[model samples]
Target: MKITVDLDPKLVWQIQSEAARRDLTPGAVLRERLVSSRNTLELENRIRSRVMSGMCDADIAADLRLVVGTIAAVRRRLGLRPNRRKPGWAA
Candidate 1:
C-alpha cells in the first residue's frame, strides 16, 4: 500500500529528525501517530491486554479484523516487544 508522493524537503528532514530522536524509523513514527489518532480506547485496550497475555500480532489482528501492521502499531504504542513465542507453547 505504499504510494510515492512529493513532499517538501523540509518536511522530509523533519520526519527523519524526529524519527532519529525517537530511535524509530520515520515510517514507524508515522504509523504510530496515525494509529493513535484513529484507534479507539476500547480497541487499544483489547490489543494491549491480548499482547500482554502473549498473543502474536497476527493472531490478534486476525481475530480483531484488523491489519497486522495496525496491531503492531498499537503494540508499539504500548511499548511492548513483539511476541515471538506462540501462546501456550512450551519453550
Candidate 2:
C-alpha cells in the first residue's frame, strides 16, 4: 500500500542521509524510522503519564507490559523519582 505524506525539507534530507548510510531506499528508511519513532513515543508517553500520576514502578511495569527496569529507565530519562506511594489506580 502506498500512502502520500508531506514531509518537510529537513525530514526529507534526514531520510536521504539515512538511506545512503544504510544502503536502503528512502522509503524503506523512512518507514523503519517512523515505525520505531512512533512506537517509542507511544511507549514513553504511557510511562510518563503513569509516572507523573504517581504510579509505582512495579505497577507501571505491569501496566506497560514491560519489565520493571524498563519503567525505571523511562523514569530516569524523564528525571522522575519513584513514586513510593501506593498504586494510584486499582490493579
Give the per-residue lDDT of model 2 (tens digit) for 1-91: 9999998999999899989998999999988988999998898899889988889888888877889998899889988889875734654
Off by over 4 Å in 1: 1-39, 85-91
What's the lDDT for candidate 1?
Answer: 0.84
RMSD of 2: 4.0
Q: What is the C-alpha lDDT of each candidate?
A: 0.84, 0.87
For candidate 1, report its TM-score: 0.51
User: In TM-score terms, which candidate is top?
Assistant: 2
